[model samples]
Target: MPNVIEALQPTLEGAAMRAVFALPQPLRRLIAGPPIRIDDQELALDAQLLLKLQKLTGQTGLSAETAAKARAGMARATKITAGSPVPGVVVAERSIPTDDGDLPARLYRPREVTETGPLLVFYHGGGWVIGDLDSHDDLCRFLAKHAGIRVLSVDYRLAPEYPFPAALDDALAAYHYAVDNAADLGSSSDAIAVGGDSAGGNLAAAVALRTTRAGEQKPVFQLLLYPAVDATRRRRSRELFGNGFLLTDHDMTWFMEQYSPQESTLADPRLSVLLADDHSDLPTAYVVTCGFDPLRDEGEAYAKALSDAGVPVVARRFPDLIHGFANIRPVGHRFEEALFEIVGTVRAALELHKG
Candidate 1:
């Protein structure tokens, strides 16, 4: 009976979440407390409720725990939030050849492919400390199913175990592996893109810049979801929405500390991609930021930097959403809607690139 209840947990949670989201916006806002307005942006009703639920349940963050424990906690949380895998997307276990042992990877392929179509090499976001392929599984599936593009989800080494340059180097290695094997992956070399949320987003941006300057195969596109572009400085968002917004500044500091313990390593452009000297002629990019996220300003700043550098970039801000919304789409109707919109944007961008 216990096992059965455990198995039915996601279903139960899903139903409850759906019921909450089904409520009228005003009701949700009322339940989540009065409208939360900051920086001239009002929090969306759904986002407010989600945060309220988290706070009520004492489910803020796991920053104070050991890396091992935090990782385990993250996995359990992913199970509840990921909901169910979408149908029609084929998932396969694969390995990315890297010097630091073969990294585990999951390839998400749409039922049909053009062989020369776009393929996004994705890194799961956990501030480079906690998340894994499983945490971002549903996201990969949705991207593949909705955008009609293949997704290569890489499980790069985490921090405090494999610090700073380790993840970045491994990410580059995985991207190189993808480039060399794009044909076998049912995608062309020119159609491959790099993407991730938060830490993963930081990796994608770094990888793109590295490949561009290092005379390697350049990626054609980038899909950065609230990337942590500059960890060196704090922007207004950090102070405004630092607490009760799902991703707290305390957690952010802890994550970065775990990723790069050595104080000297903080200034490296690979860790803070926004500090990189150049950002021109890299790849077409779609950068998504959340209005209530601490990392929002840094992400937008990076997007602006990319645009000023003459790169074709689209920067979208979900004014009512909070950070890490993509991973919680299962029960979050508003998040699901925003995600689909992002998928459509990706599809259109890829189509135009192919033209």
Candidate 2:
């Protein structure tokens, strides 16, 4: 990974292309105190985020250790700018026992809860290498508050250290724990769902598949936000948006290397849900994809697979945004709108299950 200065020092051709693709909002924000909103267009924050990320990456590089620090720092900054916590949501820390050890968890409960509210087991995204409960705390709070559902954010073990089956094991264990102990968490076991973004999204989908294969009680729903369904990275999106977007193809490869170094593991359904033999009889899915994200094609593909297998699925794409836009508050109203859309979908899905 290039340093901040090195990364931002693009070649003449690349610089020219960037200038052509850059949006005026980010440029305006650079000069002025706030972003100048023009017409509603896609790539609204592309230039802004891209520039910020380039500087951060340039300073920190993409080494595992540095990336972890950078991610932590960014999460802290995001929290500061995330404004106040959503009202009517109660948050509590939890320790969920897994086969390996005790996994840290955070429970977000809506104030207006009934005897049987829906529970969403959420996993945070960090390419299975970075991220934790803190990174996604705000998003979870918003979901719990606006979606009117309880959210259990699992802090699964990351890669290089734990690797492959570890995170998956943790995810599955957390799901089962939520199901068996749902009542204790003030949610109904039958109304439980699984959700996550990126690598976390992959884990959520894998858990759903594993549950289906085991003939266990399937989750009521699966909410995948820009999930990496294909570990093989064969999707065309990898080549298209793999460069300038927040998550690069190189970053994806780095993550895969850290998580599953062995090429043989690529085909494992737990690692690559898209390669699973059966997608039928899982659960209803709400898949979100970003047009500029390298994982977009695979996420959409997974959604299509679910729909083909007779599962009720809703796939929505935000053409203007990049990967991880949901967590970046600086992206402006588009981020809030997208987050609300996601929460709305979760609410509607849970309601349908209740009905």
Which candidate has the highest lDDT of all? 1
Q: Specify the poorest-scoring 10-residue window by lDDT in model 2.
A: 31-40
Off by over 4 Å in 2: 1-41, 46-81
lDDT of each: 0.89, 0.80
Residue 322, model 1: Cα distance from true site in angstroms: 0.5
lDDT string for model 1 (132-154, tens) is 88889999999999999999999
Provide the clashing-pair count of each candidate structure. Answer: 0, 4
Model 1 CA deviation exceeding 4 Å by range: 1-14, 24-26
Residue 64 deviation, candidate 1, in Å? 3.5
Per-residue CA lDDT of candidate 2, range 36-155, in tens? 232243465543444454555353223344556646655544543354567788899999997799999999988777566889999999888888898788889888988988999999
* Cα error of candidate 2 at position 354, Å: 0.7
Residue range with the least summed lDDT across 10 consecutive positions in model 1: 9-18
Task: Assess the local accuracy of residue 176 in candidate 1 as a C-alpha lDDT between 0 and 100.
Answer: 92
